[model samples]
Target: MKMFLSHLDSPLGTMLLVTDDRQVVRALDFADHKAHLHRGLREHYGEVVLAEILPPVGIVGALVRYFAGELEALNELPTQTAGSDLQRRVWGALRRIPAGSTTTYGKLAKELGFDDPRAAIDIGAANGANPVAIIVPCHRVIGSNGDLKGYAWGLHRKRWLLEHEKAMKPAKEEGRTAMLPGF
Candidate 1:
């Protein structure tokens, strides 16, 4: 399949967006990880061609809204990932994680019905291998001890994402509910 490539300037850094012919996002990663992004594409699609062009405006708008502090804006963007069954399952679980919350690798493993240490490690690997970044939400997984762990994009960006979501949650909640009892 031919991959369309585009670049977006974000507060965190420059991001590369790759879309399939149908315009579904195939991968979104930091520009600094270009090599890894290409490697992932090669691994998944095998002998694919990449063409530079403008990405879908709606997707770009969603990202802009997200970085502008509308945390839920990212949830609506469509993404397509290529991976094994376990990887796909883990990626789906990652998306289900709420914007302001987090889960440990071990906890994620448990949620997936895995209890062994090896299973947790496998989950972590899948998380690291995630093709799409923020939309897939792999950054929300932390260490069991609550420390920030491996993020393919970089730990600093992971911290920023968690903090951004944390700061936005209260405002989001306030807009959704009434503080007082029946008025």
Candidate 2:
């Protein structure tokens, strides 16, 4: 299968977006992680054939809107990734995490039906292997103590994304407040 590739310039840094012929996003990672991206693609799909094209406008637009404070813009974009059943389940749960909220690995593991704390290590590994970055929302996972933890894109970018989402959260609430009958 031929993989379509494109570059997106984001606030944190440049990102490489990979999609299939049908335009379902397969991977999105920082441009600096080219080697990591290639390794992941090779592992997931042996012998990837890459072709460059303009980024999918709808997906890129959604990301742009997300960075511009419209956090829900990313909610509707389509994605496709190759992974184990556990990894796919973990990634799906990651998307359900609210934009401004963080969940610990233990919490996520429990949510996925794992009651033991050791399950968190497996959960963390799945999070680390998430193919799509911001769209999958893996950055929202943190340590049990609420410390920012591992993010494939780097902790600095993780901090920035969380802060950006948090800052936008108030604006959403304020908008709701303004529409209420009483000030």
Candidate 3:
């Protein structure tokens, strides 16, 4: 498969966008994880190739806008991924994570109808393994205490993403009974 690479500037830093003929495969923060990401991509896809795929550029633009607090819901990017059935389900669930919102691994597990909270860890693993980044929204997953946790790119980028989402989303009324908080 031919892959395309683009460098995008956002609030955090330069982010690298990677994609194939079908859809976006990776969106990585350019903080300190670039080398690691490059190695991983090389190992997974065997080689790195660049092509002109404008569809993903729109998604990258939207993401840049989102980081600037200009977009509330990211409904623009079309997600295409390669994974198992359960992994696909997990990716779908990640998309449901609203912009300027966050969800815990436990909450995500519950959304997938898993009874045990430990299933949350499995959900997290699938999220980490997601080939698509912002479009799939694995970064929207937070810890149980609403703390920013692991991201394939890095934790700093994770915090930046959560903050970006919070900036776009309307403020939640305190004590007004939230279906979810800290999102």
- Candidate 2 TM-score to native: 0.90
Clashing residue pairs found in predicted model 2:
none
How close to the true structure is residue 34 of candidate 1, measured as C-alpha lDDT?
A: 93
TM-score (all chains, Cα) for each model: 0.89, 0.90, 0.73
Candidate 1 regions exceeding 4 Å error are: 167-183
User: Candidate 3, residues 1-183: lDDT per residue as tens digits?
Assistant: 477776666555566677666654554435345676567566555676656444365666677666566655356666565566788899898888777678889999999999997898899888887765566788888888866778886665565556556623333459452222223
Query: Which of the two candidates, 1 or 3, achieves a greater TM-score against the reference?
Result: 1
Write one digit per residue (lDDT tens) for candidate 1, span 1-183.
788999988877789999988889999988989999999999988987889998789999999999888988988988888899999999999999988889999999999999787798999999999999999999999988888899998876787788788822322345663222222
Candidate 1 TM-score, C-alpha based: 0.89
When sorted by TM-score, best at the front, the candidate numbers are 2, 1, 3
Which TM-score value belongs to model 3?
A: 0.73
Question: Model 2 off-target regions past 4 Å?
Answer: 167-183
> Best by TM-score, which number?
2
Q: Candidate 2 residues 1-183, lDDT tens each? A: 689999999887789999998888999998989999999999899999999999988988999999899998998988888999999999999999988888899999999999989999999999999999999999999898878888888876787788788822322455552221221
| Pairs that clash in candidate 1 | none
